[model samples]
Target chain A: MDFFKRQLPTLLVLVLGLGMIIQYYIPTTFSQQVLKNVNLWIQIIAAFTLCIGITSLLRTHYTKIRLQHSGWAYSIILYIVFIAMVILGFYRGIQEGTPFRWLFDYVQTPLSSTTFSLTAFFICSAAYRAFRARTMEATIMLIAAIIVMIGRIPFGDMLSAYLPSFIPGFNDMAGWIFNTPGMAARRAILLGISLGGIATSLRIILGIERSYQGKD
Target chain B: MGIIQKVLNVDRRVIYLIVFLAVAIPIIFPLNLPVTLTEEVMGVYNEIENLPEGSPILIAVDYEPSSSPELNPMTRAILKHCFKKNLRVVTTTIWPTDGSGGSIADKLVEEEARIAGKIRGKDFVNLGFKTGSYAVVIGMGEDFKKTFPKDFNGNVLDKLEILNGTHSNGNSESSLPNAAFSQDARAKKINSLKDFSYMVCIHDDSSVFTWITYGYERYGIKIGTGCTAVMAPGNYPSLQAKQITGIIGGLKGASEYEKLMNYRGEGARGMDSQSVIHVFIIILIFLGNLTYFILERKKTVRG
Candidate 1:
């Protein structure tokens, strides 16, 4: 059982991972065909992951409902909405002007938009409360933040235009800040992240990283 | 606490109310603010503008409904531009999609195509959603036909004029000389991702990186991106690195594109609300700092 569960998956990863890596260099017809087949398999596997997610959601919600846990009422709502969406999707199809499409356009979109819009309020509140200039570094950051926040808006550009043509406006200054020093820091951080990613991938490919499989 | 401190100490609910007012009032009574054009946004505009008429370009709708408000305008403007330029657009999505499918790529492209007085299969096509995010990109890089055998509307790819060349399937129409000739030079057949004139990916997430790494770097396809405002900063590295041709970032970017197109759309309309909210936030931050400094000075004198 251990061998079937652990050894086999590890072996498959080692072989397939090595094959995928080598495939990039080969550039032959056979390698192309292999890459195509592998990509299809990956897609099929990805689709099944969605199924697994649905199944997990069902199990968790079913348990909560069965136990009559706190907030179990919300679970009922989830089930109703989930089943309704599924039935509508399968019945009339997801094409234009169907009940499914109508529900999507009217119901889902507004709900999502409203939820995301709430962030603006929270952000405003947070900026008012937490954006204090205590230290020198904090002061510098606060100033930069002010420039970027103001510059991103059309009103900022309008205000900037009143200044002399020779002097750069908040727009130009913000662009420089974002593109120059900001990009430099981002590039360094991203390079470190990518290198770390490659290392983790190598560890997994070599079967040296089994943490993802969970504890025995 | 004095007036400044009292104002600073106002309930969080007041802050929320103010933000709501700031956003809602502008939408009702638009500021009609002038949106400034930037070099960053012009990059996307110039690329599509310069493409030969009937040249095929790929559009990836890789955002969800949460980002729809910001990204939808960019998508619409870009689509309008592509159709106006008579460029052949092939759209696909890898964003799993909220089962609540509002404003999806296929539907948006269909709407834009109809308005442009262009035929669907000939002028553009939506290949629809596929699984395996980046792997789907690699698959397309290898061969579009194999990755997407049929369009979103259940139309086989080989039947589409923009996809399969006019002379394909050995039709006797080739014998008529001019009958085989069309505006699209390579419209004969689009085999791989590299065949498209350019690819514009409207994304709210990290999917653009895969396309840039695989589609652009590996296959030499030119890429541009339109993303939500929150995502704009992350995409700057790609824009600076020239991995992408250019970017349309958030509603502001969309409004800039709208100005360039000489058309006022949702993007331009939404800028008023965006500008109001930004300025309001800036004022809040400033007031908060002023209160803090005043309180500190008083405490210092008392000590």
Candidate 2:
């Protein structure tokens, strides 16, 4: 039973994979119907999963509030927000005419915007606190960043105007760095990542990786 | 000693205020930065451009509210290109969270379609959010509607005149009458990548290749992507292999796309702020290193 349980998902996946591969040659009517059923099942599972996530969130917070932890005060605030938002969302609607629109537009949007905006601050602090010109490599990175920064702004043009004309397109050099060098570097990384993904998928298919199944 | 300590230790709020000012000043006063289009972004443009007009295209809006700032511009840029070429578009989302609700992708597509004078249920159709991870995508390849029962507005997809040519009353393989075709007959015949021209994945997540392999791979459909700067490099090989036609990574990619299309949108406006903050970070780094060096040298001399 343990062995079957362990290999069940793997076996099912193989069967599904075979079905998918063979569906290509079958009549569109038959293939499309099978595809449709699979899609509906997925939607059903997704709906249930959303509930699971919400329940997990509530369970963790309720447990915190129940135990009266040191940070229980914060948990209270979170619960209030979560419950209030859910009530507003479902009771009314997210349409512009509804009161929930205020919750969505003012609260949720701003919170998210503010969180995203913090990346700028964190990046700045990280750049400063962590950046050390300790080696030639560090120096090069610093200079490249500076050049890219300047190149991206209008100031780069003003600076380049004062310099010699020998450096053609120096004003737009940063744009070129982003377009060419940055893109080339990025492409090389993406290719490696894709290959890694393919390998991982193959491992799952071949059952070489069982970590996805819980360890005994 | 006290004075030195006071000078070194500043409140965190002060730093925040200064950074806020640094970013705000640039935005309030626009800087028409000299921007040149990168090949990566231009490649995205060229991919859409090369496609014959009225070609069907699948656009996966696989992001939620959290990633709107990055993915929105990418979507807008691609939409502008597609609409300009009169390409038939089918938009959908993967994430179930807020997927049924007011998703950013849903709002964007509606707003763009309105502005571009594209008719809904005709020019473009939003299949809304489908659940099931890779399963939803794979199912779409086999039978488009089995995954999406209704469009965003609760209309049966099979009933839509736009799908008349592609999906039959009885089956997906059977063609509908020419009179039933919405605006473009050819667009209706597109059941998969073999039917559509290309696909563009505008997402914040890294699982774009999963769709490429599952959906596009079988049909020989070309795939391209737009993602955050951090997610950009990971797609380079796909871009290199020509599996993905091109990529627009982050705000910079959006900016480049905006420039190439000659339509100044959010990417152009955001460029000033992005550039300014980057410069401020560089200055902070310089100051930090200088402080560290000076303090270390003094300690060394005293010892």
Best by lDDT: 1
Which residue pairs show collisions in model 2?
A36-B146, A186-B233, A187-B236, A190-B233, A190-B234, A190-B235, A190-B236, A191-B237
Query: Chain A TM-score per candidate?
Result: 0.94, 0.82
User: Candidate 1 residues B227-282, lDDT tens each?
Assistant: 98878888889998899978888999999999999987889889889888888888
Q: Which ten residues in a row have the lowest lDDT in candidate 2 chain B?
A: B167-176
The CAPRI category of model 1 is medium
Relative to the true structure, candidate 1 reaches a TM of 0.94
The DockQ score of candidate 1 comes to: 0.74
The best candidate in terms of DockQ: 1
The deviation in Å at residue B43 for candidate 2 is 1.5
For A1-216, candidate 1 gives per-residue lDDT tens digits of 999889999999999999999999999999999998998888889889989989999999999999999999999999999999899888887777788878877788778888988899899999999899999999999899888877888877888979898988998888988898888888898899999999999999999998877798
